[model samples]
Target: MIDPHHAPTGTAYATAPSIVQEICLIAEASGSGPSDVSGDREFRLRKAALLDCIAVQERARYGVAASADADDAAEVAAEWLVEYDVAHSGLSRKGRDLVLAEEYRDYVRAEYEAWSRSQAV
Candidate 1:
């Protein structure tokens, strides 16, 4: 099985693995962001990261975890990101209506796969 816990800390993914790790890293984000980000952006990212972690953790209480859980968590996190964009970037009405779940899911799946890939199983 792939172990996502020790995966590299990069999130730039071009594809996705069909299955996730035994544990989800998105649920474990420490929220201790990089020390370089010192501004409202950092706070906003932390808040969104909190949203992502909480939602994913909550999602785990249901039935067996599925790949879609990542999508669900990403969608929830995107809500906060959209709110920030609306307030700061002036997102269009169309933009406000959509949650960029795929992008965030890509991150989740990518992180999991990174650890999974490094494992022997």
Candidate 2:
């Protein structure tokens, strides 16, 4: 139970990916065992943390896009990031309750690529 909110900002940002990986490990461990109350609770918490980490990564990347306004592409990318942040926030709190399925990831990736292409034009 790491409280991602209480973690130092730099440390939290740097370790987000690791946090997600840790959650995956927890999920794998629980998958191997029979269902238990405590395990279920742990899984839920880890999933929430994973979602928070993902949001943090997205925001960080968005910040980069916002700051790097060298041309129209960068500007469009920044706008896309803003829209993404708003839509994603509206969807779920740090995506905690939402399932992070492959389809969802693919959709986000597709949106990102489209944004990049828009910048190229």
Candidate 3:
């Protein structure tokens, strides 16, 4: 229930392609030639997952009432994203990605809901 209006816009998240680009670079360096079909597919999937997580986090952080504690929400969301990145950094070819997992999204939603309730009280 994030307030779309309160969500930060035009920030680095909007223009930062470095995250996915770095992943692609790594794939290429790992002996999966630049044109490797599997590598390309993995890159696309990873990119989508990363963006989805960002969107989810942003909504969870900003969707709450404006009166809620913004600082606390922001901190929690930031921490979550960092941990998510670390967790997915070593994904194997056949390993399910965090972004594609319903459990991870649910976890974020649950955390946000808890934080929002705490702030409301």
Stretches of model 2 off by over 4 angstroms after superposition: 1-17, 36-39, 63-121
Candidate 3 Cα lDDT to native: 0.42
Candidate 2 residue pairs in backbone clash? 73-119
> What is the TM-score ranking, best to worst?
1, 2, 3
- Global lDDT of model 2: 0.41
List, residue by residue over 65-98, the lDDT tens digit for candidate 1: 5535553655665555555556776765364335
| Per-residue lDDT of model 3, residues 32-87, tens digit only | 65565433333433333344445545456566454244334434444454355445
Cα lDDT for residue 16, candidate 2 = 29
CA lDDT of every candidate: 0.42, 0.41, 0.42
Inter-residue clash pairs, candidate 3: 1-63, 2-62, 2-63, 3-62, 3-63
Question: TM-score for model 3?
Answer: 0.26
Winner on lDDT between 2 and 3 is 3
Residues 1-121, candidate 2, lDDT per residue (tens digit)? 2334643222323322375476668678667766663324334333433443454444455754552333233233333433444464454424533233322433333343344355558
Stretches off by above 4 angstroms in model 3 are 1-39, 64-121
